[model samples]
Target chain A: MKKALRTIIFVTTDADAVAAFNAYFNPNEVQISHFTSGMGAIQYVKQIGEADLLILEEHIKPLGAVQTIHYLKDNMNYSGGILFFSDSDKNEIYTDNEAFEVLKKGFEKSDLDRVLGLLSNKKKPVELNSKPYSLSYLINLSEGDDIFIKESIKIFNESVGKRILEIEELFEKEHYKEVSNLAHNIKPSFEMLENNLGSKICDELAHSQVDSSKLEQIKLLRDEYMNVQECLKQDFPELFKRV
Target chain B: MQRILIIEDNPMVVRSLEFKLKKDGYDIVVAEEGRQAMKLLHEEIFDLILTDLMLPFVTGTQIIEHIKKNYPKIPVIVLSTSTQEDIITDAFKMGVDDFITKPFSPSELSLRVKRTLSKL
Candidate 1:
């Protein structure tokens, strides 16, 4: 009989971290899901009934890592391994029995491997079939509901093109703040779709100063996103039939 | 059913709040701006109001003022990212019942909302 794959949920607001995490685990046997907000992660945990292992980034927006930990423990009674990754030297610590483990962000893969080893004794390499511009991330988000995946992709295809244009125009107008807000607003959509380049570019644009150089990057990202969507439609015509 | 008026501009936050509150059996009404909230307030009565301080057209403070004048008995909860000590203190003085910061836990926010409504 085939062994069941372990499910891992990671919550972080950082787009780059999501890309790295997704790429690192692409060839593994474990099932991984990403949430951009702590609250979303909490809701997923509550709905799903339990968590096997949860990795949380401290700087996650709308709810930081500490609060997420408190909620998981107090509200959901989540007693799983929670790997807390952060950059600051707060020097704070949680007792082991609380099931909270702290690790510094930006560590190498081996560092994470060691941490994973500490968390579970039966860590197996689970394989996930991932392709560039694949809908695997959206599939995970929708829990394999093809209809939801279809709608999400359709919406993304329709909106992102206009959003990219607006972002570029706003940057050209020297409306740095508006550019940042728009970029911040759309970054999650890209992250959810596993469009790493779009997510990464948006993150930078959100923090970027008002400069002409920014438009070039935005233009390049737009072309890439347009190409990815075209490829997606071509690759899965039936899935994106209405799109 | 207890009705809640959520005054928030962010669609993601609004959806999260609406989903969680709806799941808990509350009738949820959403207004994307302060003006829209005021319009809703004029047309309908809500048991409670949850608002973010920074809003368009009118402000959360202005909304509070309107509520105090027209519907003095209704409870209000302020949810925002503002760390200005005076803003929070002023809200309390202006009859705001509870204050929760951004990125709040959904369950915790629900508990606070429940506690605040229990008085009514």
Candidate 2:
């Protein structure tokens, strides 16, 4: 017996887009459900409880593409891939770990096929390495100046260390706004250390709405910082001694 | 020596900027926040301003507006994250001289500073 076809939720009011999608996808491989508004598409997905992918147009009634994606991902916990259709001239959309891909309007069939292939492939779980931080960025910025590197490391230890403590305290006090600002302020430190997990947490903490999840994020950041600091201390025994 | 004022709250970034620009032969003065930056602007005459958009106490936008009005001759360069496209656009509209994205190359910043100063 043939396997069930994968369902795709295409959200758009454009007749041309629907026709293009219908023409490109093989009926045997996938089934397409069309909706004119974000709300309608969202309702359909909620009712079905799952979809293989969601294709969103840049403009739609009731809610825009971004809002729809957020509602689906954040509120509904939708796990399917998302393809956003946007104008060629608009600012590119970036998400942490690239949760969605963007295809410019009037995209060719080949582009659609490529994106579909990518979306269908399951991403491999990223292996966490032993060392989650690096000094390469700082080293390069220093241009082999040991003094600058040492000073920067010291500054990171003093400032970032203190900020992490403050973030935890603020979160405990339920000062979510201050917690967010502190996260925003220290984001560059993680970027400098080349710590992706820490950076992503900071981005989430900075942008996401206030919630209990923030405390969990703060703990993660704190643990990561401690790990990085421990490694740094081991690597630079003399520096730690000086401190 | 041409002097530049860096108005940023990030110590790491401030250190990098200070290290690079000072090596490039420009005198550097640092302000850890926007209010201090505004006060420093009045007390000193700088050739250029390097500021971050998000700041404590005051904002880069307010500082830029003040510069355009009071110190129009001193060209301003903004330091922003790549994700802040809309805010960067507003900075340009407000008459900033140029912008360097965070995690920016020190060499590129040196060149931009040199170029911005040359145009004056």
* Total backbone collisions for each predicted model: 8, 0
**Winning candidate number (TM-score):** 2
Top candidate when judged by lDDT against the true structure: 2
**Candidate 1 lDDT tens digits, B1-120:** 999999976554565567668867899999989889999999998999998776767878999999999999999999764334678899999999998765445445667899999999
Over the stretch B1-120, how does candidate 2's per-residue lDDT look in tens digits?
999999999899899899988978999999999899999999998999999999998988999999999999999999987778999999999999999988776546866899999999
TM-score of each: 0.49, 0.64
In model 1, where do residues sit more than 4 Å from their true spots? A1-119, A125-162, A187-209, A216-240, B10-13, B52-112
What digit string (tens of lDDT, one per residue) describes model 1 on residues A1-243? 112255567776555666666566545544456676676567666544344567788777888777887887888788666777777564345644543556666768986676556545745433332433545444334334445556666667766767778877877788877777666656656655556677677778765674676877778778878877887687658756653
> After superposing candidate 2, which stretches have Cα over 4 Å from the reference?
A1-130
True contacts kept of each: 0.00, 0.69
- What's the residue-level lDDT of B21 in candidate 2? 89
Q: Each candidate: what lDDT?
A: 0.69, 0.78
DockQ of predictions, in order shown: 0.05, 0.28
